[model samples]
Target: MVIKKVSIIGLGALGILFGHQLAKKMPRADLRIIADQNRIQRYQQNGVFCNGECCDFNYVTPEEPCEPADLLIMAVKFNGLKDAIQSVQKHVGENTIILSLLNGITSEEIIGEIYGMDKILYSVAQGMDAVKVGNQLTYDHMGMICFGESETGLISERVNVVTEFFEQMEVPYKVDSDMLTRLWGKFMLNVGVNQTVAVFESNYGEVQQEGPARSKMISAMKEVISLSEKAGVQLTEEDLDYWLGVLGTLSPDGKPSMAQDVEAKRISEVELFSGTVVKLGKRFGVPTPINQELYHRIKLIENRYTMIG
Candidate 1:
């Protein structure tokens, strides 16, 4: 089906970055922002400041009536995913295509269960060094989106429709036939950089430095690589090297999504990253001691937040 109307959920870094770009291409009215009432007010008042420029797009709260979108992009954090899904239920027509840019391997599963398997697509955003502070967004890299079918990893007509939309918007994206491998590859990157950054409260550059932190990051990623092979995903040592290279190229002072969450005193996606690794490791009979340690450390940090509240 041709995609004319697109709705982006969440106003986080990726959401705002992609939303602004899409607004530039599509009619501003054709692109919608589905966020909470507070976030809606914030955007309505201040607009979205992206890359030193401000752009305002149409927005609606979940309580308001929204026309079913042709495509819905899920960009909320893992913790907020359940509510986000429910909020956008009214906007999901029979043919609405769902693409989740949230990190983790299981977001597609969760979205599929709610929206039906056929409507869900596998996706990940990469190469972005963006950060969101309040209503303002700043980024050094624009990033590319990779997506495809979940079951066969083959490009379907729906996939092509989304690709054509991106092409028309001049948005950088790839339609991967092996989207599962790509997701697992990105999963490994998140397990390495995101968890370690949150635990140590460090940035990408610190993790890249030759030190114990870097060693911990590599060890955690190796655990993911081992688990991926056992799960029949064919992740290799070379894949690990490639992720390491990607990590090396990130902005020195840039913080990952998890680190940003920790700093903002918001809940991090430890459950998505380290939690998934630990669960999968148990199922696959693979040891994930490093991930376990990182998971517990992040939980303790989160628990502190709970206590403060």
Candidate 2:
């Protein structure tokens, strides 16, 4: 599959980070940054800066007439996904491969349902510590993205094209055979780190400290592992320990995306993390007490923001 045209559907931190990298290698004409009018104006005025470089990619919105893209990347938050899907309809052709970097287990499912299942691919981004302040994106840790087919787990032609795309753009990525397992692994990480940081209103260093917050983080992660096993994903104790090791390696001052959203007074992705866990727990007959508690606590904080509005 020859991937000529590529479109990214969000201009958030991860979107800008990857878009900037892609713009460095790919022709400006081949890439399109999909955003709304306000964001388009912001980008038009300020541009997307990452690591001190400016992105020069074309920007478009749903109101504009555009051709379908060969590859479409969805980088929006979970709560924004439904509207994001509708916004990208004109950019998805029959052969367009949709890859989502959202932090959740069900994003691909939602995309597959709207766009045909065969067109959607499973993917997740990890190790990124990029922070967005206004239109500026700064980060020292550029993450690697993992993606592949959900069912066959085979290296298809499209998968090879995606890998080649990342390589050509000098972006780090991995093609996994068991993409579902990888997605669930990332889901567990988000459930533990993202929710804990948001609920405590702390950073990674604080979560690593010895306290009730750390205990709650571990308990929530363990519950996710149990639920994954019941769902037949085979996530084990070792995987949980591996994630803990990964967390330890992160920058002490680094804050998860949820924590950043909370600080900005914007809605976070709690629904994708603890909310999803609680929903799946009931389906699998597994008790997710830790996740339920975290979900309610985060909701209370979010409610205060809503009340102020």
lDDT of 1 by residue, 1-309 (tens): 799989989888998899999988888888989878887787788778998788778888888777899999999888889999899988899999999999988889998898898898899899888888887888887879999997654778999999998999988998888888889999999998998888888898889899988989999999999999888898999888877887777788898989998998888888888899999999999999999999999999999998998
- Top candidate when judged by lDDT against the true structure: 1
Name the regions of candidate 1 deviating beyond 4 angstroms.
none
Weakest ten-residue segment in model 2 by summed lDDT: 242-251
On residues 1-309, what C-alpha lDDT tens digit does candidate 2 reach at each position?
788899998888889888888888888888988888987897888777887788786989887888899999999988899999999989999899999998888889889999998998789898877778777888878878889999755988888989988888888999998998888888898899998988888888887778888898999999988998888898988888877877787777888999888888888888888888998999999999999999998889989998897
What is the clash tally of candidate 2? 0
How close is each model in CA RMSD to the real structure? 1.6, 1.5
- Give Cα distance to truth, residue 72, candidate 2, Å: 0.5
Clashing pairs in 1: none
As a TM-score, model 1 comes out at 0.95
Candidate 1 lDDT for residue 292: 96
Model 1, C-alpha of 84: deviation from truth (Å): 1.2
* Span of 10 residues, lowest total lDDT, candidate 1: 148-157
User: Which regions of candidate 2 fall more than 4 Å away from where they truly are?
Assistant: none
Q: How close is candidate 2 to the true structure, as a TM-score?
A: 0.95
